[model samples]
Target chain A: MRPAKTMKIELKVNGKRERREVPPSRTLLELVREDLGLTGTKAYCHSGICGACTVLLDGAAVSSCSLLAAQADGAEVTTIEGLAADGALHPIQQAFIDHFGFQCGYCTPGMVLLTKALLDEVPEPTREDIVRYMGGNICRCTGYAGILASVEAAAKALSTKD
Target chain B: MRPFEYVRPTTVGEATDFLREHGDDALVVAGGTAAVVMMTLGVLRPDYVVDVGFIPELGPELDGSRSGGAGLRLGALTTVRSIERDPAIAGAYGLLADAASQVANVRVRNRATVGGSVCYGEPQTDLPPALIAMGASATIAASTGVRTVPLAGFFEGPYETVLQAGELLTEITVPLPEPGTFGCHAKFTVGSPENKPVANASVLVRTDEAGRCVEARIVMGAVGPVPVVAEAAAALLAGEVPDAKLIAEVAARAADATDPQDDLRGPVWYKRRIAAVLVERALSCALRKAGNGTR
Candidate 1:
């Protein structure tokens, strides 16, 4: 059997454009963590069942672990590393801190990213919206009460932003 | 996952050609939600992945477009979230929207395409039975030409469909329900909110002016190799007013039609029981929506 050829592809990651030659089997999670050195995006379950590897692709939240890097070619991807700007934590991040949204912090990155996507789509989400949008991203610690509160607080903070 | 070659076909013709050339060695990936997961789990190993996700025809946002007198046409690439959030779908085809909403979570729904879900042919999925109950048909295109397969008969078995080697599912057209029709989909999930259904049922009911049952479609999913249509159950509701006793009978018939197998979700008998319960609940919900309460 012959070795598979690597393909060169470009991606817009966290406002930065990156070009890399990767094997087809390299997943978006691997691309972010390994190639891009953005380790904030955690990979708990390599399969799609867990939302620990969630990222925003073109503004839609998707499981990065289940998305091949080749499929994300020429696409804009936003990981947890992308949320902070100019040494300032994003409002969602601040809200998570204030509410103590996470205990172990393993699922924090994915949760925060998913919250960013949800807030972008629905700036003023209701409790139900928060639950539904954040349903995929599981947090074993805190039992989700703090996470839900953080999302609600973030939505309020975002709505008040000038 | 084993390394493979990726090919993004710009056109359906090109995609079909690749599929034909590679045959079993190639797999077509749309959203990559299911395909990527399966591949990473070593369940599927295709040497070549034909990605049609970038095809313009498949990427355009779905719009409300009725075909002649044939109801709404949903392009194959329509995302599950798109269907779940579409107001037109929510208002008219609530069963479909409900089913779409219940699939996995928002993230998966954002990436999983409707065509991918249907083509995956997983018996436990929510769309098959809901679409089958809605009298939906799929338009399949290939190197030869195009043909439509009724969604009810589209499935051959678990993870199997009537789609040929080189055929691509282009669109799924759901006919306008009869003027008096109302439907609902009920799914019973045992574990988390994102867990696959142990048993699901979709019921479409059409009542006459006098509130008598005129037509009905009862479909049970996740209990068999394919979405099982309770033909006998549906027949029992035709031409008569539905009562609690009749609904129970129909539900029993639907349960009897199931060929459930013991799996991680539940035992066969448990799923059979859930199927009966879901059928009754779905039928009652549909009736309530139709403004006809069971007597």
Candidate 2:
């Protein structure tokens, strides 16, 4: 058998440049929650089926648990912990708070980040667009009504702020 | 996941060279959606995992101009989301776009690639049937040379492909639809559209000036070990202007072509029934598109 190998990867995480030597099996989710101490990115289903591990990679949402940290060698990753700027919660986070987009908070981080990705791409997304784009991030709590309202509120808040 | 050696190759030639030396114990991964999941699940524990995501030539690109004869050339790394949204593909191969749009959710589509999806050879996928119906072919690269194989013959069985250990799929070429050609892809999932289909069907039909069906190809997926090309069903539609009755007959024939194994999604009988229903719906849709030229 070949010897174990580790890869040296340098990537921008939450606007801060960080470098790490990650094993081949070290997933982006592990790098975020374990190594970087950013627990905001949750790991639910280690598989890609659940969106609990969603994060923004180069402004697009992906399941962090579904990819290797080495694969994200030179990319920008935004976890839920990175949403606040200068102690002010991002508008998407505020909307979730106002609309109660989550319950139990297990799926909240992913939901909020995914909403950010959506609003960034489509500033004023229609209801159908919201439903379609956010379909992957599943929330077991609130049966999605609150989540839907939260996404709409976020889109409106961002558009108005723009 | 087990500890393993990680290798990232920047070129296809380099990738194939490494694979030729370590192919027995190495696994090539692009997109990492399927591979990482399998590794996490302990279904695959390779001593070496080759990351092909960085290879510049195996791009995340969709070039319609280079596809000779009005077809489309899709890089192995082209994300499914791109295929779903690209205006050129949407205009010329709407059925392909429709199939791509229904793959998982935006997140998975954003990460999964057309080549990876096809190469994975998982029977219950959305892209293969549409590609097969469209007469697409795959371009594979190896240390020896390169070869193009029809997508219809790319798979061996469930989660099995004809890709050799030292080989990699570079691109897929979707041929131009003959004039007067229209196609439709229909999938029936047990739950949300994001779920893998219990059964799916893709139908492409061409109509002559006299409105007679000159050619047809129907491919059914998820109901067999590999996607089934329903030649008998296509034969029935030949030389006839497809009607509701004739389409129903073709649907039955297509369903008869399936060799579905019972699983959680559906039983053998249920899959066959869904296959027939999807074929009927898809054929009806394609014929409607042909009549109106709305495709």
Candidate 3:
């Protein structure tokens, strides 16, 4: 009915294709942070409700904790590590830094990426829309005003960049 | 989480074969939002997880160019966010797009597929009522091959589906109502300042050239094991402009007919009261849009 434990998984992480044997019981979050040693994608709740474990699976945001490492075969994954290019932060990441969008910086990675995605799609999202889209991303520090401001500013920056 | 073998079958046939063999001990995970959460909580202990995410046959099916009498034929894998952005879908099925736009959050919506939401078969889920109001149907595939089930007859009970052990949902087709028709969905979620509908109401109302009510479909979500259709409510509003008297009468019938359980959102009495308020507002919204379309 099921394999014993370990399973072979192939994935493209951070622009590099990798093949590794991982435990069937291990989550994608564990494999990302422990086995592959890419810790930029933070693991907070280890549950689907928190957005701290968010990662881009084929350009879509998904909680890594909720996925099995063995299920990632032949799939392309991009963590926070993959966002910046050539040592320069992506615009959204840069916007967070400029706007001081974080206090403890635990939720910043996921929030920044989520904001980048929403602004990429919505462009001129209203304040209500921004809040609604970011509902699942919990920010315990900084009270979310700066976070919202950063996203709005980033949206303006992104629109001008285009 | 229980230790399990996670298999990714690239094709539908392969998935079907795997499900047929391992149906009893296996769980088919598409988005993994629910399954993984359940596994971590030890709520589910399936030994084998057959992932349906990578199957090409179940990808988002959107019509890019506007075609006549055309609506969306959404593949089971189409994410809620993807549905929200599709131009033709927004133009034709605004109520669905509205519902999709408001589901979960950017993180969850990106991973939550339309098929997954419908297949959830949860009585309180937000999609079934909207789909029923829009006349949506799904193509389910089993060992016997493909068959279409109207969104009406799909759900059997809470967390229960008419889907057989090895059956797979392939597609969901939502018919676009007549151009002049209007649809609205209002949900009520507690402790949310955003005025997000707590006990959502999804309604479809239309009018003829003379402003007479042509047809109507009013469905309430989050109140029953399945989205409840208001047949009597529809009959009362048919062939009539939705006036205050009609709205009051429909509201009264809804309060009497609906069997909503008391839960966190509100007590049964509160829900009954909100349903009356919501149904009237929903009716006005639909009628306003129909009037606007005729203008």
Candidate 4:
């Protein structure tokens, strides 16, 4: 067997620029959770099926578990941990808390990040849009009523702030 | 996932050369949505992963113009989400757009590429039947240069293609439908929004000024080793004004052409039945779009 080769990748995580040398087999989920020690992004199905590993890569939501760490080189990555500003929670984060969008909290981070990406693209997404956009993220605890309500509330909150 | 060496070649030529040298030990990865997942599942164990995700030639942006009867050329790296959002594609090839939009979910669509999906050669996927119905073709690059293969004859079997070692799919060109032609795609999933279709159908119909069917193409997917073209069903509508009885006949003919396998989706008989239903609905939808009343 050949020795594993590593590549040094520079990524803009949250608001900071960080670099790491990782093997090619390392997924973005592993890089974020293990190397960067940012465990906010949860990994359930290592495959792309479950959205529990969703994160924003260059402002678009993608399954980090399916994304190679090397592919994310020089890209801007945003996780659930990045939603807070200074000491206050972002509107979407606060909306999730107020709406009780999570129960076991396993799928919360991915759900929250997916909501952020959706609202970023469509500020006033309709119910159909919410269902379609958030369809990938599976929340086993809160069913999905609270998650849908939280997304709607976040949209309203963001619009009112503008 | 097993450890593998990674190489990011700058150009298509360089990539193809590297792949040729590595032989079957190397696998080219674009979006990594399929490749990485297969790797994690131990389904594929390659010694080297050629990361072509960043090559400018294979990005999500569609290149080339659709001027003077020219067809739309989509780079192989074009993301499914990008295809879903492109107004030009939606306006001209609505079936392709709808098919792309229906693939998995937003996150997967955001990462999965049109070329990757096609090259993955999964018969159950939503795009192949729609693409085959649209008369699309793919340009592949290899050490020996390039070749374009029609989407109709691209697949050899399930999860397999005619793609030789060191060959990489670079672009997919879809010819513009002829005047008075309308197309529609429909898929029937079990329950979840993200579930793959148990059976899918794509229909393209063109009606003459007298409201008679001039041309018809019916393609059925997810029920066979490849996207099955129901030529006999298409023949039923070739020169006739489609009606309820004729449409039912065509649907049955299409279902008869299916050679399905029993899997977690359903039994072979159930899948064939769903295929017939989808074909009928897709044909009716396309006929309506073509300004023909299937009464």
Tell me, per candidate, how large a share of the native contacts it keeps: 0.64, 0.69, 0.59, 0.73
Q: What would the per-residue lDDT of candidate 1 be over residues B178-265, giving only the tens digit for each residue? A: 6778888889998787778899998889898777899999998899999999999899988877889999999999999999999898
lDDT of 4 at A31: 97
On a 0 to 1 TM-score scale, where does candidate 1 land against the true structure? 0.95
Candidate 1 pairs with clashing backbones: none
Off by over 4 Å in 1: A1-4, B66-69, B292-295
TM-score between model 4 and native: 0.96
Q: Rank the candidates by DockQ, best first.
A: 4, 2, 1, 3
Which residue pairs in candidate 4 have backbone atoms (N, alpha carbon, C) closer than 3 angstroms, thus clashing?
none
Which lDDT tens digits does candidate 2 get at residues B1-295?
A: 9888988888999888988898889888899999998999999999889888998898777665655575888889999999888888886688898788888877788899998899899998999999999999999999999999999999899988989999989999898888888888899998666677899998889998888999999999998899999999899988998888999999999999999998889899999999999999999999998888788
Give lDDT: candidate 2, residue B131. 96
RMSD of 3: 3.0
Highest lDDT scorer: 2
Of 2 and 4, the candidate ranking higher by lDDT? 2
Q: Kindly report which residue pairs in candidate 2 clash with one another.
A: none
* Chain B superposition TM-score per model: 0.95, 0.96, 0.92, 0.95
- Per-residue error for A67 in candidate 4, Å, reads 0.9
CAPRI grade of model 3: medium
On residues A17-82, what C-alpha lDDT tens digit does candidate 1 reach at each position? Answer: 999999888999999999889999898877676799999999999999888898899999999988
